[model samples]
Target chain A: MDNNSKLTNLHMDAIREVGNIGTGNAATALSRLLGRTVDMDVPVAEFVPIYDVAAHYGSPETYVCAVLVRTEEEFSCSLIFMIEEEKAAILADLIIPMDISGMDEETRLQIRDSALSEQGNIILGAFLNALSQITGWVLPTTTPAVARDMLGSIMDLVASMFGVIGESAMLVKTSLHIKGLDDELGGTVIMIPDPGSLEALLSKLGVL
Target chain B: MTQPIHVGMADLVVSKHPATLVTLGLGSCIGLVIYDQASKTAGMVHIMLPDSREAKNLPKPGKFADTAVPLLLEELAKLGVNKSQLRAKMAGGAQMFSMPGKADSAIFGVGSRNVEATTKLLAASGIRLVASDTGGSKGRSVEFSTETMKFIVKTLGTGTKEL
Candidate 1:
């Protein structure tokens, strides 16, 4: 966003702290759902060119299951929860205790989709709630939408929203890791505040 | 020793024979390619939105359908490629996220709108649209080679297609 030059090191540190607190709350909510310990990595808050956002996350062409939720009205931001497609199946298994090995393929797939969507709703809700409590800004999010596609496509679509007004995006990313799992089924949460919202956010923090 | 020039979102590039132009992960965005077969000169643009007039800022020309088409033509013109001989092919503009009952949302159905705007622009510019793949709920990655005049479209879970 254009306000990048206006943001100082203090503003960035405050944003990172906000990310840490929000994601820390989300980790607790996720752990409650999966009945396992969930650990969060230190959040990364940086400004990345719109063109390189996908590459910064990972290989652009790799397939990922993503859940997207956009803030309504005031904040004008979005949150994308991304996990590997293969890992999504494991995520569904942990959330739903019923044995689906005997069910038909279609039914199993439907259940899996529902499980994933519910997981997204819970995690994103927790994160937003924490942000709202901290910022005292009414940040209501839209219904979550899920898609499994190439990360490049997903990220570029999001980047385009930022590109409309600016050349780069300020991304706050936090990775969630499930404890005691040989293969991690955790996902990454990316928060993108829209062009004007960043300035508004910083002003709310009295940093602008 | 040909290298493929990568086009990012809201970006455009022009190249000559043996040089491939590629754009990845297009969702609600159009990837338009215009090429002159004789000179083997080609231009590719990743258009994010449909119109520039509605944008708040003076966005890059490559970011909108209305502006990108003309800019692509002008770029090709600089390479000594005639507009009369230019043929167009495109892929992408897919609705990545489905928002139920939120038709008024800004991004809702943007894929089809982008496709419509690009099609109208190409027709108005007198460039023949040879082929296209648009209006789906899936994202696409496209590659165009000026040498072979081949446009390859790839998607996850679905096999690749040559347009």
Candidate 2:
């Protein structure tokens, strides 16, 4: 490999390490929230063409629920927590003591919305906390926003918001699985540093 | 043979009869289509931004509304399509996420601005926009068939519609 390729590999490794730490913390938070053991896969970090983000997860038309939270001021990044809509309902049922199926439609929706939002907030908070500890950077995140839609549609917004600065995006991803549950209960978390923020992040880590 | 052409984000494609140009999962992004019925030719661009002024001078003209519209027309012109003979149909540009009390800000208005830019440019170019399914809180996938001259849109939980 050339020097550039070698440097890219090192950078990717550093990013993956960051993801591992962040997701590990996030999995712990989920485990506490659900009272179930949460297992996390080793994180992956790489640069991807912005256009291919949706297809990277699955078919672009796949219906999914996503919660996006962004860090404002100082170091910037957007973190998206996504799971199948059906799976998110399962998650909500697991958290809410009452059986959601017994409730009216509006009440069930309210409960589900609050449950999912809180889970998103906690998971993202834990991940950001880990990163702040490592980089000593203040990462105040925006209120988490949730959207349920096709993967492609959600990613289109993400790509547009991030694609303003470059043709490619750096994505750090990890999969979280609740122990004893089927794989369908798992969800993925993706962290994308805002354009120009990756360099600052790497510098903070002494990896650049 | 009927073929399907896939248009990715910030990309554009043009095809003649017996082809369907499809772009999937558009949220806050406009899928701009220009077609000539007589020639059975159509071009579609998945536009991400409203303008290209802020982007570096690269050749990816389909990434922004200001650039993609003219670029699509130029490509169609090469296919023997006259600007005056073209009609437009578009879908997408939906605000996919809204936070409480933040819906009125510019950050949440990208979808509308994208729709506005494309419409203004199309009007200036004299292309009559005959059909559209443009704003809402949902994401849309669109398929434009050159053979049938139909713009079919699909969204989650919602049935398909022909615009």
**Mind giving the per-residue lDDT tens digits that candidate 2 earns over A78-155?**
888999998998987888887668779889877888889889999998999999999998999889899989999888
Q: What Cα-based lDDT does every candidate model obtain? A: 0.85, 0.86
What TM-score would chain A of each candidate receive against the reference chain A?
Answer: 0.94, 0.93
For model 2, the stretches where C-alpha displacement exceeds 4 angstroms are A1-7, A182-184, B101-108
Candidate 2 TM-score versus the reference = 0.93
DockQ of each: 0.57, 0.69
Q: Which portions of model 1 show Cα errors greater than 4 Å?
A: A101-106, B1-3, B54-60
- Model number with the top DockQ: 2
Q: What is candidate 1's CA lDDT for residue B137? A: 84
**Model 1: residue B57 alpha-carbon error in angstroms:** 6.6
Candidate 1 structure quality by residue, lDDT tens digits, B52-125: 88566654789889989999999999999987899999998888888787643665667788899999999999
lDDT of model 2 at position B28: 89
What is candidate 1's fraction of native contacts? 0.57
lDDT for each residue of candidate 2 in B10-111, tens digit (9 for 90 to 100): 888998787889998899899989999999999999998887777655457888899899899999999998778999999998998887766754556788
Could you tell me which 10 consecutive residues in candidate 2 chain A have the lowest summed lDDT?
Answer: A1-10
